[model samples]
Structures are given as structure tokens and as C-alpha cells.
Target chain A: MNKGLIIAIVLIVAVVLFMTQSDKKEVSEPAMTKAPPPVQVEPSPAEPAAPEVSLQEAFEMNRAMYGKGHSFAWNGEQHTTDHPEEIEASKEATQANAEALLASAMAKNAEVAKLGFEWKLTGDILKKAQQSIDQGNFQQALNLAAQAKYHARIGIEQYHYAQANWHLSVPE
Target chain B: MKIIKTLALNLAVASASQAALAADSGFDMQTVDPEADRIALQNYFKARFPETEIADYVNGIYAVDAGSREQWEELEEFPPYEFDVEKGEELFNTPFANGKGYADCFENGGIGIRHKYPYWNKDEGTVKTLEQEINECRTDNDEEPLAWGKGAIAQISAYMAWTSRDKVFDIQIPADDERAKAAYLDGKKFFYAKRGQLNLSCANCHVQGTNIRIRADLPSPQLGHVTHFPVFRSKWGALGTLHRRYSGCHKDSRSKPLKPQTETFRNLEYFQSYMSNGLVANGPGARK
Candidate 1:
């Protein structure tokens, strides 16, 4: 209650109030200020990504894996690839070559089926190939038979791949 | 340099421990451990849906989704499979041409023997399914065998499944028979192997993709998949055997479906049934 003490207290209170206000202003200053404008980045011009391999190219690559004289072996039976060369030599699709191709396809499909990895479309394709043969469309038949054979080969490959890698998918 | 050496030592130790842990937990393709696989699979679903009871897995998709469960419960009140069960019962009771009925062929008069199916026949050296056995019974009795996939075979299976309502799956892979173990392993391989143009395995949908919607359908967990057999699916609009469903799944995968009761399928059933060993049979089920 002394005059000097009261004056001193008032001055101290004012100082504290001033400091509190200053602290609040400092805390809120960042929020009140505008954020920096977003950076405008121009994407660098670059060459377009290379296109993926075409289906025909992929098919040719797959076919190349089985060399000219390759013999497909399954269940103790070996199916030689002389039919492709024979067809190529004939220059035109022949019933004999078509039948041979179908036989090879059937052999491969049987192997795949035994493994329980036969593709659903393979049988239908084989059937279509047979129908094409019946209709004397030997070229179409040859193509269909080759497609079926391709599917069967893929199925066999899938089976082996699965055998090797199935454990990788098993939940730990 | 000392810090780097210490860090390297820590890394090596950490990696060694990790490898040890992986070896302990990892499933061996060569090894046939049905119980271990079952436990791991069930645990997966349990961890995935902590709220769900293990026994409730028999409900299939209903166990995961509440919305579907409510609809299913409502459907169960007036079950669609009732007529098929009745038909199955009649067929099961009818005597063969030789005066021996299906009852004469089975243990316990075929009342509640659905859970013990896809057993390895040691003498025959093959996996024998209920459906296969039923046909065998017919042939033994001088009766013509029923067709494979649907119709009478499915009906009879449904009746047998109905009789086995609460019986838990108890498929056995005989420890003495290496062939039985091989069959199981083969089935396991088939289940895990990615097939067809889709390149998807059974585990991809049922195990990893459970409760995850694909288009309009929700793939159920694999834990209790075999519990419901000869199910009356809304898609089918009639009861169909488990093999029939297997064929459908194969078709969906764009893989050629093997004929019903093929050796491969029998093995698959053997593996699947073994996985559901602890889960109760709740077949002759109606599903959407």
C-alpha cells in the first residue's frame, strides 16, 4: 500500500502484460503471415518412353527359345520339331503337316493336362483347329494348332515355374 | 571406422536373426504339414479380422461382412437348399437294382460321414472322395453311376452334408503313406500356383483378398471354405458339388477346369478339407 511500492507493482504488472502480449503476437505471427507461393516447376522435355514389344515379336521370341531342331520331351516321350521345318519346306499348308502339328499339340496338351496346368483356351483352340482341318482350311488349322501348342508349352512352363516359386507365396 | 564396424556387425547379427526367424516360420514346399498350414491360414484371418470368431469362418463371406451376414441370416430362415436336401435324402434311401441301397455301402449308414471324406485309400493308392465313393458304391451294387458334376451326385452329397451339420472336418493325411503326403503336397501346390491368363492362385483371392471386393463379389477366406460343400449358390440357382464349384473357379481364372473327381481335384479336396479340420461342417449351404 506504500505509494512507491504500488507504483513499482503497477510498472511490473504493465511490463508482464506487455511481455504476455508480445509472446502471443510472436506465437500468432507465423499463422497470420501468408505462406510462400507454390513453386512453378516446368517439367523437362525428354524422349517418350520406348514402346513395349509387340505380340508378334513376343511370339517370335518365344518360338525362338525352342530352337529349330528342339525336341519337346514330356512323360518319357519326345516330340521332335521336324513338323515346323516340313511345313516351311512345303511352302503351302498341307493336311499331313497340319495333322502332324495337331498331333504335337495334342501330345503337349496331354502333358499339361496330366500336370493339371492345362489352360482352358487350349482345348477350345485345338477343337477349332480340328474343325479348320475338316473345313480344308489347312493354313488356319496350322495356325490354330501352333497357338494350342504354344498354350500347352506355356502351361508346362507355368507348372515348372510354380513348382520352383510356389513356396515364395506361402504366408510366413 | 569403429562406428562403421559396429554398425556392420549389428546389421549382420540382425540379418542372421531374421533368417532364423524366417526359417522357423516359412512353409516348406517339400514338407506336408496340414496342421501347420491350417494354423497359419486361420491365424491370418484371425489377425485380419480380430473381431471375428474362428468358428464363425464356416459362415464364409458372412463371417467378414455384417451387411452380407444380415442378408444371409434372413435367407437362412427360408433356406433355398431345403428342397435339394429333401431330394438328396430320398435318393440316398432308394434301393439300387441289386436291392442294396447307398446305406449298405457306407459306415454309420451314411448318416454323418461327410467330414471324413477325400481320404487316401492305401490299398487303391489314390485319394477317394465321397462323390467318387458314391459312384463306386453304385457300380459295386450293379447300379449305373451317377453323373459327375451336378444333379443326383450333388443332391446326394447335399443330403450327406446335411446329415453332418455340426461335425468338424477331420480329413487325414496318413503319416505312414508317403503317397498320401505327396497328393496333399500336390494339392497345396495347385492351390498356391498361379494359373490361367489371369495369373492368380486360389490364395490370391481367398487368403490375401478376403473381404476385399472384386466387382460385385467378395472373395471369402480359405479357412472354412470346405465346410460348406454342395452349396446352393444364387448364381447356380441349384445345389452343386464342391468339385463343380472348383470347376467354376477354374473357369473364372481362365484356366481349363479338369473334369469332376479327377485325381488332381481329389487331391485338392484332400488338401482343402485337411485345412478345414478344426472348422465344423456346415454344408448344404445357400450362398449368394
Candidate 2:
């Protein structure tokens, strides 16, 4: 009876210890190893790679995101708009992509001007995005950079259309 | 020689076909009657706003919008253009170093002569505006010409407009001048041509969009619009010429404005003024 009682007590203590260690591991996890936090994502370099998506996630994300836009025609007039929200592989990737878009949009300055459109408003939005980045509004900044890109693209098309119309009309 | 003959035959056939199509649709401007255009244009305006008198058309938006007209009448009490008019009169009367003033450059000593502007200059073979004549006047007297859309030009034009007050527009496209007719047609084309990102034309706003609220603003009828010149716009915070207003319209439509007094603009003025041929000058007008 005494031996059985001692074994039961020992098993109970071991189980208690195991559970306590598990709880400790859960509590002490570095945020990087866990899922990403909501907005104001400041992903550190030390973040562990997400187990679900690995080698081809970036390409897959882009392929899926870039093709998500839709177009429709109403009353004989065709209308189109973009999907501003993108499904990025990671918050850091989203930031990096936004930076690239900003650079490319800025580089197309001459092309935009040639299309007879000025980018003053777009440029101002870009400045605001930079300010947002410095002020820790990374997600907002990304959205704004995307808006600027959209404006630049639309401006280019409008410029070309106006230029063609002028040429055809005035021929001067 | 055989190939040339075949090409010539094909070209002649193509020309005949095009001419036949034009004849069917009456699509050519070559023989358009300016007098007919004026009558039709005035009739259209009169038919639309039956209550407004023919002469009152020169008052522009005021002839349509009673509330805005009341405000304008009140503003006219102090008359926002008074200072500019005074400055312009001083400038007009001031002689150049050679003792020649603007009066020396024009017939009738530059007074009561604004109605005759934007006329076809037979020698120059181009349309000339009041602004152009002012510049010519200055240059002839060995003085520097003012920038076309600048405040100084507007001020001078304001004084000229005031001097010619109530003189009905007498724009004439001489019977024999095809060049003048072509210019007039081109101006009409410019007015009606859809342009810019907004896909707007001068006609779209002033004709079709008249009395339609565009975010709390109404476009006035195109008739008699040319009667007003060097208008004091609250938005501009200063006097602006008719071309300046036209340039604003261009910019508003997201199109780059051609420089003031370009052949395109002068021709545009020639046709626009001709449309309101008998409306008296109601210029140096003030507006929001």
C-alpha cells in the first residue's frame, strides 16, 4: 500500500513539473518567433521564418495580388480601378515593395511631364508617406505610397490622351 | 508613268467620295455664313432664357442667376475694378519718352474703340486682340511690351473696355476673306472640340452645362461672354483678361494652356466675339 501511494505522488509531481515548463516556454517566447503583430509592424531581422510559407511565398503573393484587379463596363463606357490592398508575404516585404514603387514612380518624372501632367500632388503625397515612415506609421505610409503610384499611372495616360488630342486639333 | 497614272486615278476617286460624303452631311466649313451663325446663336440663347432681354445677355451669369447678380450689383457699388481702371487710364494717357502714347498707335485716339478688336488684320493676315494692339502701340512708341496675361495688360485692357462701354460688338468677317473664315471655323472647332482629362469643351460648359450646378457653380451661356474683358475675379484676387480666364478653363480641364494671344486664342476670340456681334461691351466686369 505504501509503495503504491509513493509512486502515485511521484507521478503527480512529474506531471506538474512538465506542465509548468510548457507554460514557461509559452510565456517567454520572443515575438519574432510568433505570428506578426497587427498594424505598426516593426519586424525585426531576428524573426524566425514562418513555418507555413517558405521559399516561393514572395512570388506566389505577387502573382496572386497583382492579378486581383477588376474592370467593368456600364452603359457603353468602360470603367476600371485597382485593388489597393495587397496580400504581401510579410510586413517587411510590403515595406520593401512600397519603397521600390516610390523609387520607380519618382524616376518616371519626365515621362509624366511629357504626358502633359504635373506630379505636384503625387509628390506631396510621397513626402507625407516619408513623414509617416519616420513617425512609425509604416502601414499608412505603404498605403499612401500606393496611392501616389496610382495617381502617377493615371496622370501618364491622361497626359498622352491630351497630347494626342492637341496634336490632332491644333496641328500647330 | 503607268504607276503614277494609277495612283492619280485612285486619289481622284478618293477625293470625290469624300466630297460626296461631305455634301450628304453638309460637313464643310468653307462656305459657312457668320451672320447666320450669329442669328442662330442668339435665337438659341433667347429661346432658352426667354425672360432675359437681348441686351442683358452681356451681363453673363447675372442674366441667369438673380442671387449672384444681386451680389455683383452690390460689389459694383465699390467696384473692385476701380483701382485698375484708374491705373490703366493713367498708363494710357502717359506718353512714352518720344512723347507718343497709346493714343498715337490707334485710330480715334484709342478711345471708344474696344468693339473693333480681335479683328482680321488684312496686312498681318492674322486676328488681332485689344491686347495685341496695346503691345503694338507700346512697341511703336519704343516702350517695352507688357506680358500678355500679366496684371498690367489686364489693367490697360480694363481701361480700354471701360472707354468703349455700351458699344455693341461689331465683329465682322469680311465677305471676301476666306482666311478670316478659316480662322473663325478653327475657333469654332476649338470651342466645340472635347478636350482634357475631364473630356470637356468650351461649348460643353458654356452651352450644354449652362445653369447646371457643378459643385455649387453654374456655367454661364457662351453668348455675350466676349463682351466682358479684364474681369476682376475673386478667385484670382486681381484683374484677369479674357484669355486669362480661358487659360484658367484650360488648366481646370487639365490641359496645358497655349500662351495668350497665340493664333489659336486670337481666332477663338474672333469667333466668340462675332457670335455676340451686337451685345454692348459690359467689360471690366467683376465675378467670383
Please report the TM-score between candidate 2 and the true structure: 0.62
Candidate 2: clashing pairs of residues: A115-A159
TM-score of chain A of 1: 0.50
Which portions of model 2 show Cα errors greater than 4 Å? A1-68, A71-172, B1-27
RMSD of each: 14.9, 21.2
lDDT of 2 by residue, B8-102 (tens): 46434533442332222111365466676677667766766898897888888899889889998999899899999999999888889999888
Off-target runs (Cα >4 Å) in candidate 1 are: A1-104, A136-139, B1-30
Error of 1 at B136 (Å): 1.8
Give per-residue lDDT, candidate 2, residue B218.
Answer: 72
lDDT of each: 0.81, 0.73
**Chain A vs. true chain A, TM-score per candidate?**
0.50, 0.42
Native contact fraction, candidates in order: 0.43, 0.01
The numbered model that scores best in lDDT is 1
